[model samples]
Target: MDVDARLRELGLELPTPMTPAGNYVPAATVGDLVYLSGAGPLRPDGSMVVGKVGDGGLDLDAAREAARLTGLQLLAALRAEIGDLGRVRRVARIFGMVNCAPGFNRTPAVIDGCSDLMVEVLGDAGRGARSAVGMAELPFDIAVEIEAVVQVST
Candidate 1:
């Protein structure tokens, strides 16, 4: 599929890639695999969707949107690193983290936001193994964060 065209078809615009907040690079390519660092719910205008999930924090829907936005952030970084997303062979795996109130266990449902977008954008190549976990807090208290590993044509 033409990934750029797909984004336009979906009316989804990728955010500008953010600089690494710490010491590490946003993505690293080892051979044909591109390992994406964790990205938060950073928006196109340089703001973040920050809050906890469940309970006294964001509702499930809001948190899910946060995950979707984070997915966009990761995509932006991936494109910046690789120059063309068309080179992607498949999305290998996803690691999603949700900042939540105490005892929130519906993490997977929230992270499905990002996962679903992957399938929507990349089709079969976007379906991949994934893990979703809850965290007491995340950097900047962003609602969701996601990291991915992708296999690409060399």
Candidate 2:
């Protein structure tokens, strides 16, 4: 299926790409590899979803949702850079970070939210190497953050 069709089938619409909060660009391409800057769960209105997994009333499910949102933001950046999701040959690597309370160790499960969405939207091309790590804290105290590398057709 085409990228737009797949997104419609999943009932998802890409948000506008966000401007970088700092000096870095949202995405940069080197040859066929596109590296996306770390993204957080920012709503369209620009408010962030903030919390720590396993603490302050947040839980696994919430963190997973946050990860999914971060993934969407990454996609938004990719689209902004390449202008066509169809040009993506494969998702290459993803690094996920989850802000967690002490003793929490379910980072992988949370990051699966992002991984599953990528596969759902792009099929096998979305499968990739990944790492999920826990963070004591994150910018904005967001529940999760993710960065991605994608291989695109030249």
Model 2, which residues run further than 4 Å from truth?
none
lDDT of 2 by residue, 86-131 (tens): 9999999999999988989989999999999999999999999999
Per the 3 Å backbone cut-off, how many clashing residue pairs does candidate 2 have?
0
lDDT of 1 by residue, 1-154 (tens): 6999999999998888888999999999999999999999876678899988977769999988889988898889999999888888999999999999998999999999999999999889999999999999899888988999999899
- Model 1 alpha-carbon drift over 4 Å, by segment: none
Clashing pairs in 2: none
- Tell me the TM-score of each prediction against the true structure: 0.97, 0.96
Error of 1 at 32 (Å): 0.9
Clash numbers, per candidate: 0, 0
lDDT of each: 0.91, 0.91
Rate residue 104 of model 1 by lDDT: 93
